[model samples]
Target: MKFKVMAFLVAMAAAVPAFAQQAGPTTDLAKLEGGVFTVDKGHAKILFSYSHFGYSTSYGLFTDFDAKLTFDPKAPTSSTLEATINLDGIETMVAKLNEHLKTPDFFDTAKFPSASFKSTKITVISPTTGTVTGDLTLHGVTKPVTLDVTFNGGGTNMAKKYDLGFNATGHVKRSDFGLGAYVPMVGDDIALTISAEFNRVQ
Candidate 1:
């Protein structure tokens, strides 16, 4: 009876590593092949929030944007991220407020149709988290910005395509981007959160 119990324990121990391996990253970026992934617009968006005169916070999102990502599971430190959001895509639940956001005092969409970010450096904080430093161009003004990024995972989908997801947060000053409207009233600091997804481009 003791021999049988020992045999059962050994079998269970051998299966533990297999279970963990099965639960690992779906795409295993370290071994990701094919090509760069393209933003799955239907599932990607930037959600932003800012203080509203110490009363409460306001939230909004950009309706149109695109992103590109390259991740290396083995050497995540070398990965890169870039995104471009249309200045005219702001939605704040109020039509007038949304239009106001695109005016000369804010994004000035007519002159700067879009905002872009291109990473210059990447620091790996862990296998699934890291810091990305890049230049953000908005309203014709360019400044350095850093984002904390985390890998959500990736894998083959029902369509036989690879999909990857990540979440990122960063802070930026509106005044620095030429968006200095109602500065102290609306708060100058913008907290940006991005829930983005990319699919292997075929």
Candidate 2:
């Protein structure tokens, strides 16, 4: 019986490499065909960082948002993109601070409940990296901003659907958006990073 058990273990070990090479659920962006994709918000986030009185870099996230990607892998330059963010979903993990952010001094959700970005141009740097120039509308102001974006990967979800992932980073001055309440104290320079997943839509 012991000999049988030892043989079984060896057989399993021999088969491991074959199983490892079997196709798994990873998306290759280059292979993706042209189509429209929408954000899987459950797997997406917009993270922001700013200096707080020079004490530390405070972080926050917009909890609710939607994004779309129009991709033509063969001709990426023709692709366009758009995203809408709900200011009401802003969360800094601190209740008081979160409340203040939604008020007139900051986001003023009452006046502009949402912000949006619509890409005007896409500069492809390679198969997996590019620059996205778009109009970012925030606090009733619109400005041209560029984001350095990278295609992280593509994969299937629990539902077994094709999806793509990406990460992007950019910077903008809050004062330019008319949200200049704190200025130097709160840090006008805001850095942002986004991790987003988009599932193809018919």
Candidate 3:
């Protein structure tokens, strides 16, 4: 019995090297192809955080969202992005807090059930980073916002199709969208962090 267990462990250890060589994304931006891409819902997320009275930070996320991308790897400035997030899907990890956030004092999910963003311009800063300026509509108000975006990687995904990934960070003032109920107490500025994966539209 002892010999059998030892042999099994040895075999598994030997397989690790081969398993690590499996095909995956490449960081080479020059190798990417330009086309339309749709979000891989399972591999994307939108996270928001805010300062809580200078003591701690509160975090939440919108689990139901989708995005479409018109990409141009050669001429990255021509790329465009558009996304819609379901405000009702916001999750704060606390059941009671979740309910409260949907109230009129906060998101008022009952009145505004969704938010949308449409890119107006993209300025490439490097092969792996850029700035995306767009109109963000939330809680019945629209404002111009810019996000600093980084190209994570791009290549053929496990599904045998080309895929692209990105990480972005930005911020907005709650007052701009009429969601500033707590103001200096809860927080007026909201920080947004996004991680997303997009696959070529086949």
Candidate 4:
């Protein structure tokens, strides 16, 4: 009887750390300050590539974007992310093609000036990776989307400011969001890639 009890206790102790790691640490949002962070537009990029004309491929980037990341990384699950991308900022290699993309046939920038994403839930899958499920509004339509997110580490920059960086990508069907202006010509699937840099408020 004595030997069995001792073994049971030892086994329980070994399992405690695993349970703790699963729950992760909780961060206090009130203790952390919030501020505006530059996306490092040069280093950061938002690009989407898709098949065109059934035989060729095309890609574009939104030249203008802004985002606010509010959270304590130590308590990552509690973080909130809000981002806005100007539809009119879409840039293709050719100037004329860029202009055509913003018209009603494509993004219809006049009707939907911008696209936005707001996080509804963030789950940490590992120390360096996680998933962000949120609502992405595009073309005047809102739909739930999930982003495969990777924590790119955080630290102080040359400006003596603390910042956090992340890279995320996901896929969405443009037609589902009312952007289905094309038929079999343009691919229905749009791949979204985002690299965001957020600075901590002092």
Question: Least lDDT summed over 10 consecutive residues: which range in candidate 3?
Answer: 20-29
Give Cα distance to truth, residue 22, candidate 2, Å. Answer: 7.0
Q: What TM-score would candidate 2 get against the native?
A: 0.86
Per-residue lDDT of candidate 2, residues 1-202 (tens digit): 9999999999999989876654553335555655789999888989999999999999999999988888777787898999999999999999999999999988999999999999999998876788999999999999999999998766555566767788999999999999999788989999999998889995
- lDDT per residue for candidate 1 within 81-184, as digits (tens), equals 78899879899899998998888878888989999999889997776787889999988889999999887778765556678877899999999877878889
The candidate that achieves the highest lDDT relative to the unseen native structure: 3
In model 3, where do residues sit more than 4 Å from their true spots? 1-23
Candidate 3, after superposition: displacement of residue 181 in Å?
Answer: 0.2
The candidate maximizing TM-score is: 3
Residue pairs in candidate 4 whose N, alpha carbon or C atoms collide under 3 angstroms: none
lDDT per residue for candidate 4 within 1-202, as digits (tens), equals 9999999999999988866554321223333344445456666789998879789878988889887777664577887888899988888788998988788877788888999989999999887789999999988899999999987766555566666678899998888987776656888888988887776654
Query: Which residues of candidate 4, in runs, are more than 4 Å off?
Result: 1-38
- Give the Cα RMSD of candidate 4: 13.3
Give stretches of model 2 more than 4 Å off: 1-30, 155-158
Which 10 successive residues of model 2 have the least lDDT summed? Answer: 22-31
Global lDDT scores for all candidate models: 0.83, 0.88, 0.91, 0.78
- lDDT for residue 70 in candidate 3, whole number 0-100: 94
